[model samples]
Target: MVLQVSDSDPAKWNLALNNARNIQQDLGKGNVAVEIVAYGPGLGMLKRDSKVADRLAQALDNNVDAGVVHIMKRQREAWAYVRP
Candidate 1:
């Protein structure tokens, strides 16, 4: 699944990250395909002083430590963010 985070808000960052974590927890980890792709302001969560840095670290750890989820990516190369 593709989960996109486009805002700089830490709350939105958490919502997106939590959705990934919660999904991994609810449905067995590594069982399903998941991807968190960030773009524009959403990339702030990767900065040194981002408010969601801790949670971001945990998410990274979740992948590095256990290899539960798939790799997290920064959107680029003409990514499609659909608008309805």
Candidate 2:
């Protein structure tokens, strides 16, 4: 599953990571793949000094794919358009 984060808030990052963990628990590890794409101000969540850096590291350790889009404006608009 693909999880998109557009905010840099720690709470949002925590919630998204928690949800990913819950899904892994429900479906069994290695059975599912989670891709966390962070753009705009949300890219801060992946930084080393981010408040949720540990959580992001944990997710990475669990084989979750995390990435950041360099073009913020375009990525944000694309995400907005894709969301229901």
Candidate 3:
């Protein structure tokens, strides 16, 4: 199973991480995959220059891959977005 977590709220990001932890605990005996895609304002949560970078870095250390996708981009501007 692939557990895809995506949200824009900082609090919700915490919830998603907690959910992944819980799933890991419950399914440790089985095979499960988790992927967290952070975009939009949520991208702020995983910004290379963000305060939460430490936490997100830890998550990445724990096998949680944080990714960013620019859903819209123009010569003058860009829009990062994600959905699950």
Q: Best candidate, TM-score-wise? A: 2
User: Which tens-of-lDDT digit does each residue in 1-84 have in candidate 1?
Assistant: 557676788888877877777778888787855566666677767787999888787776422221112223213433333211
lDDT by residue for model 3 (43-80), tens: 66677776556667776743323333322221124322
**Comparing 1 and 2 by lDDT, which wins?**
2
Cα TM-score per model: 0.67, 0.69, 0.55
How does each model score on lDDT? Answer: 0.61, 0.67, 0.53
Top lDDT model: 2
In angstroms, give how far residue 5 of model 2 lies from its true place.
Answer: 0.6
Which of 2 and 3 is the better model by lDDT? 2
- Model 1 bad stretches (over 4 Å): 61-84
The TM-score obtained by model 2 is: 0.69
- lDDT of prediction 1: 0.61
Provide the lowest-lDDT 10-residue window in model 1: 62-71
Worst lDDT window (10 residues) for model 3? 67-76
Clashing pairs in 3: none
Off by more than 4 A, model 2: 61-84
